[model samples]
Target chain A: MDSQITLSVNGTSRSLTVDSRTTLLDALRERLGVTEVKKGCDHGQCGSCTVLLDGRRELACLALAVARDGVEVVTADGLAHDGLHAVQQAFLDHDGYQCGYCTPGQVCSAVGMLEEVKDGHPSHVTTDLEADVELTDDEVRERMSGNLCRCGAYAGILAAVRQAAGA
Target chain B: MRALDYLRPESPAAAVAALVSNPNAKYLGGGTNLVDHLKLGIVSPDELVDISRLPLDDIQEYDDGGGPGLRVGANVRNSDLAAHPVVRSSFPLVARALLSGASGQIRNQATTAGNLLQRTRCVYFQDATTPCNKRVPGSGCSAREGYGRYNAILGASDACVATHPSDLAVALAALDATVVLLGPDGERRLPLAELHRLPGDLPNLDTTLGRSELITGIEIPFSPVAALSTYRKVRDRASYAFALVSVAAAVHLEHGAVRDVRIAWGGVAHKPWRAERAERALVGQQLEPDVIGAAVEEELENAASGDENAYKVTLVRNTTVHTLLQLAEGHR
Candidate 1:
C-alpha cells in the first residue's frame, strides 16, 4: 500500500508517496535524495542511520517512514552544510574518524547525547543524580555505546563527545 | 522492499480490530524487534498496525503497594520502566536486568510487552533458510546439536531449544508476576509463571498467549523473598550480549531460616523456569553452606546437558548459591 508522508528535511519540507514498510533510512536516501542518512546494518545495529527525530537521536533504519509522517528528521547534514556542527568540529579536531563510515552517526548521536545530558537525562554511570552531568570518559563510553565503530574510532569519538560536552 | 499496508489505531479497540481482520498485520511498539525481523524477512507482515499510540504506556498498580507489586504497560519503554521510581525501589532486579539488556538505543526503542513476547534469538530462527521449530514447528530444531551452548537446559525438548530472551522476565517470574492479556473477548491475566510452556509437546507455541490477545501489562506481586533479589548473568561478553547461563534468585529469611524462596534461570530453558523443587528444598532449612549447596545440587540432578552445555549446570548452580548467599548475608 502506498502512503504519502510530509517530512521536514533540514530546512524545507517535502511530501512524497512512501511504502508503509519503507524505513526512514530508505525514504531519506531513495525518495528524498538525502544520502547522509546512511544505511549501515539496516537492522539498527550499526547506528549509521542515526538522525534527530524531533531533535532526539533515533535510528532511522529501525523507524518506519509511515510512523514518521509528521515528525521532523534532522540528519548529519542538517547540523552543518559546509563544515560541521560543534560536535563534528570537535570530532574533526580530535581525529574522531578513520574511514568516516561511522562518523556521521557518531556525530549525530553525540549531538543528541549532549542534548540528553543538558536535559538531565542520566546514563548508567550517572550515579549522583544531584550532581551536574558529567561527561567523563566512562560517561561518554556508556552513553555512546549504541553506535559501534568497526574501524575502532572509539578513542577519537570519545574525545569528540568529551570536547563537545565540555567534559 | 515490499510496500506494506499501514494502519494507526488510536485506541485499543481499534488496534484489536486491525489485528483481528488482518492476519498479515503486526502491532508495532518501539519497532525494535519487529522492524529488524521485517528487514530480515523472518516475519513478513503485509499490514503494519501502529499500536504505539495506544493508551498502554502507563504503569499501574498491581499487587497493592504493601505486598503484591506494580503493573507495567506494554508500551512502557525498557529505559523508562527501569528508571521508574516504583520500579527502581520495588524491583531493582527488573531494572538491573533491563539495564544490562540490549544497548541504550534498543532499550529506548523496546517495550516491555514486546520484550516479554519477543521470540528466541536463535540463529536458525533468524535465518529463514535454516530449520527452526520456533519459526516453523516440526521443521526440526537446527540448533539442538549445532552451536547450542547457549540454547537451553530445562523444559527443552529435542524439537526445540531456543531460550526466552527477556532478562526482566526471569526476575518477574521469581517475584511471582502476572501477565495481563487483552483480546477481542475481554481482559484476562495469568501468573507470569504460567505464561511460558515447556517445548516438550508443542515446540511451536512458546507462551500461553492467544493469537488475538495483546499482553497489556505485567503485574508483579510483591514478596519479601526478593528483599535481596539479584540477577547474575554469565554471558559471552560483559555488555551487549546474550547470557549463556543466568540466574534470577530471591530468598526470604525468617528466624535465620530460608523462607519463601524463588528461583528462575534465563538462557537456561525454553521458558523462565521457577525452580520449585529447589525452592522447596531450600525453605525451612537454615541458610547454611551445606544446606544451600544441597538444594542447588538437587535442582540440577535431573538437568540434562550436551557436550558444550554441561558447564551451564555448574554455572547455574554456583551462581544460584552465590546470589542466595549474598542476599542472605545482606540481611545480616
Candidate 2:
C-alpha cells in the first residue's frame, strides 16, 4: 500500500505517494527527483545521505519516508538560498572536495555541525566541561568523521570547516 | 524488501495496543538499525508501529525518594543524550561510550532504545544467506568455526558466539540503570542487566522484552561512583568502529582504598559482561597492580575462547586493568 506524505523540504512542502518500504533517500531521489542526496552504500554506514531534519543532521537512507511526514528536510542542494552557504564557499575556497562525490553530504553535515557547536553541544574531544567547545582540528575531525572522502581530502576539508567556523 | 504497513501511534498506550493486536508488528524508533535489517531481508514485519512521534523525548532529573536520578526518553537521540548537561556531569562514562560508538550522523538518527536493542555485528548474521543461530534458530552457528576474531569469548554458547555491538549498553550495565517498558497491561521497570539475556541455548531470542512492550525510557540512579567513572574503548580505528574490547569502570575510593566499584566489558560477550566478581575482589582492597591483576584473573577463569579470539582475553584483561588504574589515579 502506498501512503501520502507531505514533506517540508527546504521551505517548500511536497506531498507524494510512496510505499512503506521507501526510505527518505528513495523519496527524495526517486519520487521528487531531488537527486543530490547520494545513495552511497545504500546502507547506514556511509554519510552520503546526510540531511537536516528539523535542524538536526541524520542519515536520510535509514529514515523511513512515512515516518518523516511534515518534517523539514534540508539537503546539500537546499543549503544556499541565493549565494552559497558560508560552509559551501569555504569548501570551494579551500578545495575541500576532490572527486566531489561526497561534497554534498559533507557540506550538509558541516552545516549541522556548526549549528551544534553554536548550541554548545560538545564532542568527544571536548574535555573541559566548564568552558565552551572550540572548533579545533581535533574537534572538527571528530565531528566530521562520519562523512568520509575517498579522495582523502580531509586536510582541505579541515581548513574549510575552520575557515567557516572562523576559528 | 517487502511491502510493509505503517502505523503512526501518537501515544505509548496506542502503540502498545497496536503491537498487541498485530502478531507481526515492530516498533520503529529511529530506524538506524531496524531499517538496515529490513532492507537486508533479515526481518520483514507485517506492520511497523511508528513510535517516533510519541512525546517521550525529555531528559529529566527527579528525586524518587532515594536520590536524584535521571530518566532519559527512549526517543531521545544519542547525540542529545550524550550532550545533556546532567548526563555529562553525572554519567560521563555513558556520554563517552555513546560518543565512541557509530558516527556523528548515525548518532543523530540513533535513539536510546535502539542503541540498547542493537543486533549483533557478526558478518554471518548480517548475511542472510549464511547460517547463524541468532538470525535463524537451529540453523547452525557459522562464527564458531569460521573467522571469529570479533566474536565473543565470555558467556558464549556453542550455538552463538556473536558479541553485542553497543558501547552504551556496557556503560548502562555498569551504572546499574533500569529500563522502563510499557506493555498492553501496564508499565514495568527492569534492570538493564536482566533486560539482555545470555545466549545459553535460545540464541533466537535477544531480550526479555515482551512482543508488545514499548520501551518508554531508562532510569539511572544517582551515585558518587558515576562522578569518577570512565570508559576506555580499544577499536580498530579512532572513531566509527565497534569496540574490540572496551571497559566501563566507576569507583569510589576512600583513603586510597577501593570503597565501591563497578565494571562492565563490551565486545567480548553475548550481553554486557558485568565484572561482579572483579568488583567484589577489589572492594576494601588497596588500589594496587597485583590486586587488580588477581581480580582480573579470577573473573576470567571460566572464559572460553575460540582460535582467533584468544587475543580478546588478553585484550580484555589489559583494558580492564588499565581502566581501573586510571580511575584509581583520578581518585587520588
Candidate 3:
C-alpha cells in the first residue's frame, strides 16, 4: 500500500505518497526530482547514492523512504548557502571530478566526513582517539573510503578535502 | 523486488507479536544487507517489520562485580558500537572487527542484529536460477564443486560450503558473549557460540534462532584480559571488503607465561571458528613463537579445504600466530 509521508529534504518540506519498497534514492530521484543523488548500484555497495541523514552519512540505496519519514535529509543541493559551499567550491577549484558522475556523492560524503571530525568521531586510521582527528591525506582517504571514484580523481579529491579543511 | 507491506512497531513486544502473527515476515534493521537481497530477488518476505525505531539502541555497562561488561542493544548502529568508549577500551577486538567489516556509509546504517544475521556472499546463492541449498533446500549446492574460493574450510558439509560473513561475530565469540533473544514465549539467552550452526543436513537454517524469536541485544562478559585483545583481518582490499581469513585474539600473561587466551576466526568456517585447542595450548605455556605455531597447527589439524581455498589454511595459521604474538608483545 502507498502511504503519504512528509519529509524535510534540503530544508524544504514536501509530502508525497510512495510504495513501501521505494528507497530513499528512488524517492529523491523519481519523486522529488533530486537527480544529484545518483543510483550507481542501488544496493549500497556503491557510494553514488550517498546522502546526509540528520547530518550523518548514510547510503540512500538501502534506506527506505517510509522508514526515514520526518528525518532531516540534506543532499548536495542543500550544501550551498549563497553560492557553492566551501567543499563544492574546493572540489571545483581542485578539479576533484572528471566525468562528474560521482561528484555529488563525493561532495556530500566529504561534508559528512568533516562533520564527523568536528564531532570527534574516530576513523580506522585514527591512531590516538584521545586527540583531535587531523585532516591528513591518509585520514581523509580512510574516512572517504566508502565513496569510490572510478575515474581515478582521488588525488584531486584528496587535495580538495585538504584545502577545504584549511590544513 | 516484490511489493511488500512495511510495519514500524513502536515497542519490542509489538514487534514480536507482528512477527509471530505473520509467518512470511522478516525483521528489518539498517537494511544494508536485507534490502540488497530483496532487490536481487533472493528473498521475498511478504512483510518487513522495521525495528529501527525501537528503544534498543543504547550501549550500557553491565558491571556485575566481576568486572566491567557491555550489553549492546540490537538496534545499535555498527558505527556507534565501534566508536563507543566502552567497546573501544574494554573490547578493542570488537571495535576493530566492526571497523574492518564495512565502509563508513554502510556502518552508519547497519545494526548489530542485522550484522549477525547477514547472509554469505556466495555467487551461487545470489543467483536465484542456480542450485543453492542455502537459498532453497533440496537444491544441490553448486559452490561445493564449482567456484569455492570463498567457501568454508572448516565445519563444511557436502550439502553446503558457504562461510558466514560477519567479522563482529568472530570478535564476540572470542569475548564469550551471550545473545539475548525475545520470543513469543519469553526472554532467553544463548551463548554466541551456539547461535550459529554448521551447514549439516539442513543447509537452509543458518542460525538456531526460532522463527518467532527476535534478537534483543548481545551481552559481553567483563574480562580484564579482553582489554588487550585485537582483531586482524586479511582481505582483498583495505576497506569495504569481506575477509579471506580473520582472527580475533585476546591474551593475558603473568611472569612471561600465558595466563589466559581466547581466539576465534572468521571467513574460514560456517560459523566463527573458535580456536579452543590453540587456547588450551597457550593457557600454561610461555608466549613463544614455536608454542603459538604448534598450537595453531593442532587447531587446523581437522580443517578440510577444497582446491581453490587451500591457501586459507596457511593464512589462518599466519594470522593466528601474528595476532597472538602482537597481544603478547602488548603485555611485555
Candidate 4:
C-alpha cells in the first residue's frame, strides 16, 4: 500500500502520494516530473542524484520519498526562476559540463559546498583549520569529486566553481 | 527493489518500537548503506524505520562529567561530525579519516551509525550473481581466490574475505569509543573496538547488533593524545575513493616517551583492525620511525595476503609508518 508524503519543493509545498520504496530521485524525476534532479547510478556511488535537503546537499537516490515528510527539497530546476544561480551561471560560462547529465547535481553540491565554506566548515584538505580557506582548484576538485562527469570536464567544473566563488 | 512501508520515527524509542513491532523492519539513517542494499536485493525489509528524525545528532566530550572525551550521535552526519568543534579539536583522527575516504557530497549525507553498519564493497556481494558468504550464508566466497583485490587479510576464513570500507570506523576503533544501542529494554553500550567481529564461520553476522536494536550513538572516552592524532589513506583515486590501506594513529608524548598510543587500520580486516598489539609496543617507548614501523609491522606479520592484494602489505606498512610519524611530529 502506498502512503501520503508531504514535501516542500522550492517555495511550494505539496502532499505527494508515493510508495515507501520510492527514492527521492524517483519522486522528483518520475512522479513530480522534475527532470533536473538526475539519476545516474541510483546509488550513493554517484552524486548525480544530489539535491538540496534543508540547504544541505544529499543523495536523492539514497533518500526515501515517504520518510521525508516535512523536509524541504530543492532541485536544480527549482534553484533558479529566470536565468541561473551564480554557480550555475559560472558552470555554463566555464563549460563545466559537456553532456550536462551531472551538472545539476554538481551545481547543487557546489551550493552546499560553498555554504560549508561560508560557515567556516573545515575540510580534510584544510591544513590550517583556523585560517581562511581559499576555494582553489584543489579545494573545488576535492569538494566536487562526488559529481562525476563522464565527459571528464573536471578542469572546467573546477574553474566554474572557482570563478563562482570569486576567484 | 520492491516497495515497502516507511516511517520516520520521532525518537530512538519510537524507532526501537517500530523494529520490535515489525519483524521485517530496518532502521534507516543516512540511506547510503541500506538504500544501496535495497537496490542490490541483498536485503528486502518490509518496513524502514527512519531514524533520521530522532534526536541523535550530537558530538560531545564528557570531560566535565569525567567520562570519555567524545560522544557521537547515530544520526550525526559524517560531515557535521567531522567538522564539529569537538571532533576537530579533540578527534582529528576521525575528521581526517572521514574527509579522506568519501567525497564531500557523500560525507555530508553518510551518518556515523550508518557508516559503522555499512557492509563490505566486495564485488561479489554487489554483483549478487556469484556465491558469497556475506550475501548468502554458506554460499562459498568467490573472493577467496578470485579477484580478491580488496579482500580481508587479517580476519578471513573459507567463508568470506570482504573488508569493511568505512575509513571513519577505523578512526573510531583507534579512539576506543563506545557505541550506545537502543532496544526494548533501554540502552546498552559496547566498545567500538568490540562492535565488529572477525568473519570466522559466520560471515553474515558482522556485529552483535540485533534486528530490533538501533545504534543510538557512540561515546568516546577522553584521551590527552586526541589532539595529536592523524589519519592517512592510500587509494587509487585522489578523492571519492575507497582505501587500499588506511591508518589512524594517535599518540601522547611525555618527556620523549610515548605515554599512550592508538592505531587502527581499514581495508585490512573484516572489521577495522584495532592494532592494540602494535599500540602496546608504542606505550612508554620513544616515537622513532624504526620502532613505530617495527611495532606496526608486528601486528601485520601474520596477515595472510592473497596474490592479488599482496601490495596491501607494503601499502599498510607505508601508511602506518607515515601516520605514526605525523602524530609524533605534531607533539614537537
Candidate 5:
C-alpha cells in the first residue's frame, strides 16, 4: 500500500515512497527530514502542523501524503531562503514566543493569512461581507484561532502580526 | 492506523464505479473529517478513492428546469465558497455559517460535500474505548448518562442523543437546498432536509445515501428571503468552538406583516431541525417579540432534555427570536 510520489518542497522536487496511512506532517518530518512543520495534535484540533500547500494555509496532520502527491508544500523553514522573512523578523522583534513550540506554525499561519486578506477573504467577525477586509485585531485573532500557543503568547503574536501587516 | 490502498479516479462516474467495485472503499474528500476518524481507529476502510482533484470544483449559475439558482460543485472548499461574490450577495447566511464553523486553515481544506457528511462530535464516539451506538451498533451510549452538554434535545431517539455539528447544513436546510448525487445506477437529486436522517432505530446510519453513491454537487434555488438571510451561533467561545445552540433565519415582510419565513436550528437534533411549526405560526403575523416567542415555543413543545443540558431549550428559543427580530429590522 505504499506509493512513490514527488512533492515540490520549498521549490525543490523531492521524491519519496509513503504509506497510504502516513500523514503529510509525518512524511515531511520522518521521511523527507523537513521538520519545520511540528506535530502537536495528530488530530486536526491543534494547528501546529500548519503548512502552505500551493500557497494556501492547510493543516498537514489532516492530509494524506499519497493524496497530496505533486503538491507544492512550503514549510516554515522554506519561508526564508536568504534572509529572515518579514513575519519571522517581526515575531522576533515583538517577542512572540515563550518556549517556541508553536512559533513555526504561528509564522506560517501569519504568512498565509496575509495572503488571504489580500485576496479579500472574510472571517467570522467580518461585519460587511461585500467590502474588502482589513486586518483588524479581531480579524487576525479570528483567522489565527486554529493555531494555539499553550504558553499564552497571543498578545505578542498579535502585535507581531499587526507589525508585519503594516496595520 | 491501518494500511489501505489509494485510488484517484479521473471522473465522477469512474469514482462511483470504483466504490461499487469495493464494498469497503470510501470516497475521500479534503480529508479533514475522515482522516481524523481513520487516526482514531473508528473506521477501517480498506481503500480510499481520493476524489479531491476531480473536476467538481466550480461554482456556477445553472437552470435545472426548476428555476435559476447556483450549482456548487462538491469539491469547492469552505473558505472559497464563503468568499464567492454570488454567495455573499445572494446567500449571506451560507457565507456566515461557513465562517462560523471552523478555523481558517481547516476551512481551506474542508470541502462542501465533506462538511455535509461529517460525523457528530460526540465524545463517546471519538473515544474507541467507550461504548457508542453510532460507532458500534447495539453498544450502549455513554453520553446518555455521562456529561451530556452537547446532547440533542429534539428528534432524538433513546439509542442516540448526539447533535449534528455542521452550521452550513443548518443554513442550507433553511434555504431549501437540493443535493445531487451520482451512483452506479445513475444521477439523482435529494432534498437537503431529506438527506440527513433522524436517529430512530438505526443510530449508525447518518444519511439516506446508497452505499455506492457519491455527491456531485448541490443546487441552491434563488429566493428573496434567502438573499437577505443571516446565521447566529451561540457557542462556548466567540470563535473556534461548536455551537451550543444556533439559529438560521430568513424573513420576507409584506405590508409590515410576515409574508414568508424560513428557519432551522443546529446543535439540537441528529439532523438540522427545520422549524416548520414556527414558520407556520409566524405567517401573516406581526414581527413582535411576543409573537416570535410564541412561535418558537410551539416548535419546542416536544423538546426533551436531561439535567446537564436543560439550558439549551431556553437558549435555542432566545437565539431564534433574536435572530428573527434582527432580520425583521433589516427588512424595515
Candidate 6:
C-alpha cells in the first residue's frame, strides 16, 4: 500500500513514500515536515487544510497523496516565500485572525479565490453570469465559505480579502 | 483508515477491467467523499482504482445526428464544470447548483460523477456505530426513528428514508440529463432520473450501476428551457450546509403562459424528485401563485413525511413555487 511520490512543496521538491490512505494534508505535514497546512476536521467539511494545488484551491485532507503525484503544492508559508503575499499582508493589516490556526487556510483560499475571480469564475451569489466577475463582499464570503474560523474572524477575513483584491 | 492498494489505469477500459477483477475495489474520483468514508470506517475497499487521471475530464460538445448537446466527462471537477463557458451560458442551472452545493475548496476537489455517487449525509449513516441499512444491508435504519430533520419526505420506504444530497443531481434531473457508462459488456446510456434508486427493502444499493460499470460521462441535450433555468437551495445556513429543500426549475413562458417547464426537488426524496406531475400541471397554464401552488400540491399528493421532517413537504412546495415565479419573472 506504500507508494513513492514526489511533491513540489513551496519551491522545494520533496520525495516521500506514503500509504495509499495518507491524505495530501498528512503527506505535506507528517511525511514532508511541511506544517503550514493544518488539519482541522480532516474531512472536506473544514477548509483548514486548504492549499493551492497546481494554482487551484483544493482541500488537502480529502485528497490522497499518491493520487497527486508530481503535483505542485503551495501552502500559506509558500505564499510568504520571498515576502509576505499580498493576501497575507492584507490579513495581518486587517487582523484577519484572533487565533492563527485557521489563518493559513483563509489566506490560501483567498489567494485562489482572487485568481478565480480574475478568471471570471462565478459564485452562487453572482447574479450576472454573463458579466465579468467582481470581487464583491458577497462573492468573497461565498467563495471562502469552505474555510471556517472558530474565532469568528470572518469580518476581518472578509475585509482582508476585499483589501487584497483591491476592491 | 486501513491501508489500501492504488492503481492508476491508462484508460477507461483498463480501469473497468481492473475493477471487474477485484470485487472489493472502488473507482477513485476526486476522493472527497470516498476518503472521508474510509476515515470513518464506513467502507473498507481493498483497492482504489485511481480514475482521476483518466482522459475523461473534458467538457465537449457533441452531436450524433440526434441534437446538439454537451458531454461532461465523469472526471470533470465540480468547480471546472461550474465555471465552464458552455455550462455557465447554456446551462446556468448546473453552474448555480454546483456552486450552491459545497464550499469552493470542496467543489474544486469533487468530481461530477463522484458527486452523484456520494453517499447520503444522514447523521446516522455517517456514524459507523449506528445501524444504517444504507451503510450495511439489513443493519436496520436508525434515521427512520431517529432525528429525521434531514430525512426523506417522498419516495421513502419502510427500510430507509435518507435523502439524496447532491445539488447537481437535482439540476441534472430537472434538465433531463443522461448518464453515459462503460460497463464490462459495453457502453450504455441511462436517463439521469433512473440512475438513482429509491431505498426499498434493500437500502444498500444507492444506484442502478452494475458492478464494474464505470461512469464515463454525462450527456445533456441542449434545450431553450434549460438555458433559462436556475437552482435554489434552502439550507440551515447560507453556505456549506446540505439543503433542507432545494428546487431546480426551468420555465419557458410563451405569451404569458407556460410553454414548457421542468421541476425537480431535493432534500425531500430518496432521489432527486422530478416534479413531472407539477410540470404537467404547469404546462399551458398561466404562471400565477394559485396555479403554481396547485401544481406543487398535486406533486406532493403522494408525498408522505415523518413527524420531524413533515415541514419539508411545505418547504419544497414553497421553494418550488418561489423558484418558478423567479424564473417566470425573468422570462418577462
Second chain TM-score per prediction? 0.94, 0.98, 0.97, 0.95, 0.99, 0.98
Off by over 4 Å in 1: A80-86, A114-136, B1-3, B62-68, B254-256, B284-290, B329-332
For model 5, residues A1-167, the per-residue Cα lDDT tens digits are: 99999999999999999989999999999999988899998898878999999999999999999999999999888999679999999999999989998888899999999999999998899988888998899998999899999999999999999999999
Candidate 3: pairs in clash = none
lDDT of 2: 0.90
CA displacement after TM-score superposition, residue B200 of candidate 5 (Å): 0.7
Off by over 4 Å in 3: A129-131, B65-68
- Report the CAPRI category for model 2: medium
Write the candidate numbers in order of decreasing DockQ.
5, 6, 2, 3, 4, 1
Best model number under lDDT: 5
Candidates sorted on lDDT, descending: 5, 6, 2, 3, 4, 1
lDDT comparison, 1 vs 2, better candidate: 2
- In candidate 5, stretches whose alpha carbon ends up further than 4 angstroms from where it belongs are none
- lDDT of candidate 6? 0.92
- lDDT string, candidate 4, B198-223, tens digits: 99899998887877888988887767
Give Cα distance to truth, residue B112, candidate 4, Å.
1.4
lDDT of 1 by residue, B240-314 (tens): 777787778777788988778888888888888788888999888887767777887887777887987889888
Please provide TM-scores, in order, for all candidate models, with all chains considered together.
Answer: 0.91, 0.98, 0.97, 0.96, 0.99, 0.99
**Model 4 TM-score relative to the real fold:** 0.96
- The DockQ value obtained for model 5 is 0.92
TM-score of 5: 0.99
Kindly give the stretch of ten consecutive residues in candidate 1 chain B with the minimal lDDT sum.
B60-69
Q: Tens-digit lDDT track for model 1 on A18-114?
A: 8787888899999989987788888777778888887878888888888888889888888997766789899989999899988888888888878
Off by over 4 Å in 6: none
lDDT of 5: 0.94
lDDT against the true structure, per candidate, is 0.80, 0.90, 0.89, 0.84, 0.94, 0.92
- Please list all clashing residue pairs in model 2, or write none if there are none: none
DockQ numbers for every candidate? 0.46, 0.77, 0.73, 0.72, 0.92, 0.87
Top-scoring candidate (DockQ): 5
